[model samples]
Target: MQIVNENNLGEFLERKALKCKEAIKQNASLLNRFLNLCLVFDECKDDLDNAHILECSSFKELFLKKAKEEDGYFKITQDIKALDFMQLNFLVNQCANFLKSQGLKANDKVASFLQNSLEFVILYFACFKSGIIFVPVNACYKEDELAYIYEKTKFNYIVAEDELLAYVKCDVLKLAKSSFLKSILKHKKDFIMPKINPLDLAMILFTSGTTAKPKGCKITHYNLLFAGYFTLHQIGLRQNEVFLSSMPNWHIDLQATALMPSLRANACFVLLKRFSARRFWQQIVFYEANISEVVPKMIELIKLQNKFAREKKHKLRFLLYFLNMSNEKYLEFKKRFKVDLFTSYGLSESIVGCIGDNYYEKMSYPAIGKVFFAYEVIVANIKENKLIPLKANELGTICIKGRLGYELFAGYYEDELNTKNSFIDGYFISNDIGYFDENALFYFFSRNKDLIKINGENISSLEIENLLSSHKKINNASVICISDALACDKIIAFLELKEYPYKEEVNILQKNKELKQIEKELITLNLRLAKFKQVSEFIFLNHLPRNYLGKVRKNVLGEIYGRN
Candidate 1:
């Protein structure tokens, strides 16, 4: 990846600003498209071959026909079982009947604690057909985390893998076994369809807990459908496109970007059990996938791959990159690969916030782009009880309100107080800190809780983290707040070196030089920061800790560093 020299950084940023402003003027029509969520599908042509969902008999009818059709095949599969659409439908229908026979009613919560196999996909669709609410649990959750969710929701039934059964505190059904499918098949093929509504709960997505317990966010049928429409419109995905799905089902991005969009566009999605950095490019080339979803951490690992030919040999048109990396890192990857990188600003609470692809021409790296269709977003000073709107180029909490009860989530499941507190005057408080320029391009900073206050100044941890990441030797950086001797919070920076030149057998003198080199880089970094914002201390580590979703666990860092 190429890095711009300090001499050109200022010029590059200025040019980016000018280009963004010009692009905003040119893409005025996109704003109108953004306001009409339901009509987005209308933009697709009426040609049966061109529209995946509309041309088909129905979503349910298309499920089984794809496998039997000469052109259709098992698009979603894994090492365990490569299921064609027929097999997928068989399992989904059987599972739906099994759930009905079990006396589970519509809107009943069914926890899916299975691995990333075809069974998981089958159960997801089954829940939809049967009108059962799908609640996917991360396969990696420990017993305590699992227990927390169980106590909160009181799920009517749970479908879990045999290996993970020990974590289930209550009775559960095993997936991927013949006996279960046989029992399901014994029931009638046709089942009563529940009265459905767009506002009815379809799924309950739990947050990737950082400090507190995970809170379940209620997602409605309309919410998921709109998310699919927004994704297709934002990413420019067309019919018959191929998407690579590697992230877990628990993540909203996987469902929104890959699963839901594929269903909407009649596109093919290649599903993997888990993300494998070594196998990612090969799978893309093998399946001829046109689009891929990734986070910054995945890109960092991919950048380390020495197979240069794989970088350009695939059919990848672009990658949906979540905005978390520094500007330098983002630009370096984009420039080195010469691949289209579309970034979006969003959270699990809302499938999307501001989308960058719509403003591809005016889009600036490290910027969150513009607001999504029909979604009103603004930065407000939440610290002030009034939640007054912030002006252009001012940083504050990001607040979003969708076409009332449509684009956004329903609320936190069973937590009325927290849910009520999350909204004010129709806007859902996102606790994330960000800002937008006069041209409406948004930029994300650190979370509100991550801000470091020292000497009467509020320092953004992301700012220092971004500067540290710009250093050539630093691979990644995480900045956290620590209590200082001055009775205020101070910034503690944790860095992972790009390469460790010293081996275990290396002499002590050489190891000391390696340490000195890192210290020297920190000294250089301090020069670019304000005196108060300068890092109070530096801690080098082999790697930074990450949560289940690959987000840095800064609260864990705080706990670890507090005692030290």
Candidate 2:
């Protein structure tokens, strides 16, 4: 752990304050224009209730203006504006009214299986506005995965995309048949929407299923409002700011970092159906994006582009992306792009972007800045069943509490045992281990469950991956523990070589030598690893299966390894 400089933090806050002032001024101007227009319309119509009509009309007018302005400049891109917010809320109200007309209550949980699109946003906001609990299923999930979530959550209504509609088979269930499915299908187009309060359950985002089954994290309007506002203030977002988001909206990064903050600031949000490394720069230039939320791997791909190829592009001012970027890459990016790179840290259960470090501040360490507003974070030791809070600079599990903290989730949907096991006192246990520096900057280590145990020794799989990544010949690697009937669990290494045999190039023999070198590197890894952690077998694959976020799915790897 390292100490954060007070002066640097103060400077960052000052800059944010200025940006906020600018945003407020712009908002005020827009509001006044709308009000003036409303006044004129009210004077001409004697029967119209001047005050009431003006209020709604003013809001709508300003919202429309903002949306139109953003659409004009940022064409052929996804940009969330005041009008999009109003429209989404209006649609949500319509949906809720429709659901209520069919006898569903406000507390009824509604599941959504859709990709990142305008429809997804509309449905999500409608759920929030109608007081229905929005349960979002991962788009990548198969039939079985979707079925598990539907059963566990006991969703009363399911709004699925046309492509995924076939997977919702209610007839397949044995007990607790969904009665609302029939009503939902019957009144799909005739459902009434409702208005909602700010304290409603906005969304339930599930955790990434890297090691185990995903857990649903319940998030409320209060959680989003607080986290969204804090992120905007921290990152210095302003009105009319153009934001490019490549990450999936289902993930916390796009939801908390890009979408929510952009909406709160009245900034433009540019959405992409999927990321294309070849067209990233062109898209950014076309949209004139000021801010972008990107993963480390995406940034690496962007950095690989030649400067001459990108010479005629529009410049970006601020980039809210991942950290731990190599020094050489960071310098090269800064010199070539001339933009500030900021980093943030949070999990799906944590409501996303809880801690962040700005680029203006010198990043000497992997510090996830000071805690955001209304979040009390502490490092705690997990011993048996009890949680003990550790002192600063002492490594332990991360515990979060406060108004925003309690909103993590009541529990994992239907997983009572694991949910009951996750809490320590009133605080939600994050299950991730890390420590805070003297200056209160948090540093993440690894997941508690991700640690592999062999012969009473605990080894981090990330450590093995990092070690393998250091080798020049190995392009990608994934380390997982395979069950050995005799030895409990044995270390298995999967290697993807940088130089692979290409039929077009006729380099099969050279590629074979490269594969052999990768094996030699594995032997060296065995020398460095502890006796129990040493690899018992090695598997060579053309490529490793990774999620859009670049995280290796060990379960998938295990399945593939078994098949081979």
Candidate 3:
């Protein structure tokens, strides 16, 4: 054979490499399908064999074991009682046994009506061990709202605080917050732990009913545990840190984002009875809290407190922040408080925080941040019975897909038709409009229903609400379009003033002066804004009706406006 030259060998190698690259490109789609199929098959094969599921599938043993491994503890500030890992486990066991003796069985619902206390938390975790479905009722619910929840869940088995006993019609296990541990101490007996399937429904967190009738989200043990796992591994949660929160135990933010994640990381959660703007920061310093979560309203209230001097001694790394704030306020708040804010986004159905942004400088306008963990996020347009993927900066509905029962909630409880309608092409339709940037950072604009077309131009009511709330006189604000189709989607801003006493109790002259001055400011603001963005009218209210989460119920406001 003739000896091959270097140039000839190089040409042959290049030809082979070209063929290999072409083959890879041609099979790329097929390869992706195969990999996805593998994941599905792996999921199917998973049983009690999977570590996380194994631990959660049977709660008592693995739970106690994990607690021991982590050496975690929880401090309740209400009574100043601290429970170590073993004490907590023992209390949960007692609580679980107590529930069992009350004729509750697997899948039976237990509604808990209490504030953020150890009892509320113990009952929640105890449900996991006992295989009972836990429902944390919003602390803010009055008798009428409680009646509605009772009608929906048909749950007669309720654990209520002594004060809240009058609000519900249930087989009551009433509690006094100070004597919670003593109340449970009387029931000391070991009971057989029920077999828990990881896929079994664990909790039903209700959506904010101010917007509409609350829908109960069916969350599974796997969903909750995976949320903890996601935060621990993907979000870089450190072990054994102290987490402080006054968030109501009823909230998904308190449970999935704070409680469960802290559980997995072996961190201590310092329980505060309620949020106090005056005492909250000092308490943070007292507890040396590493992390805390807050809504925009909390931040706004704290900013209003306007406490002088930067609090330099606190161990707070950052606020696990939500909703929106102006860029000016965001910077000032950080400078004033001496603590950073980590922007994040999630919902009741999304489990834990699925999107977050920690970098400060990039937040010229806060982004919902890039989708995290194994979630499949997309901004999409559905038209003509087709789902089309949207590009960067193109406004569209946000959609997410994940393994149901693990990453996402199973479905809306007992509402099969609505659940079916909620998902399109295997993706959960969020019904929220936003856009993704070139870097895939999502920016929330408004709820799809909250978006209004004024003079043939689309406007986000939230943008108006934010601007109005930024005003010194305003306490809270919500913007809604007039119901009159003839009025061509005229914007109306409903505002709650800072010093709201009873409407009848307010000094007439002082109120009128404040209104006239605000009206003049609105006129100047109107001239400065886009023609279509200007508010047609603004109404002052004693209080903007809100749910437990402090979200303004625009639908309710729309109804109120219609009547007025």
Q: What are the RMSD figures for all models against the true structure?
A: 16.9, 15.1, 18.7
User: Cα miss at 52, model 3 (Å)?
Assistant: 40
Tell me how candidate 3 scores on lDDT. 0.64
Worst 10 residues of 1 by lDDT: 35-44
Q: Between 2 and 3, whose lDDT is larger?
A: 3
- Write one digit per residue (lDDT tens) for candidate 1, span 228-331: 66787777777656777677777777787777766555465667666666556655665557888777657776666666444566677788776466667677
Better structure of 1 and 2 per TM-score: 1
lDDT of 2 by residue, 1-564 (tens): 111121221122223334444544667465532221100000112232223322333223424443243311111112322233333333334545555664566668777676565555645655654567878776665566677677767887776666667777754322111232233233332233344444456667776422334567667666665555667777777776677776665676677777767766766666765666655665566556777766555666777765545434564766775534555766776687776667676666667566677434554234667676556788988778777889888999888775432335445555667666667776777777788888888887765546664432335666666667678877776788765432346888777667654232211122366567768767876665435556777777666766689776777777877876
lDDT of each: 0.63, 0.58, 0.64
Question: lDDT by residue for model 3 over 138-160, one digit each (tens)?
Answer: 76666656776777777747877
User: In lDDT terms, which candidate is top?
Assistant: 3
Query: In candidate 3, which residue ranges exceed 4 Å CA deviation?
Result: 1-78, 170-180, 209-211, 306-310, 358-365, 450-564
- What residue pairs are clashing in model 3? none
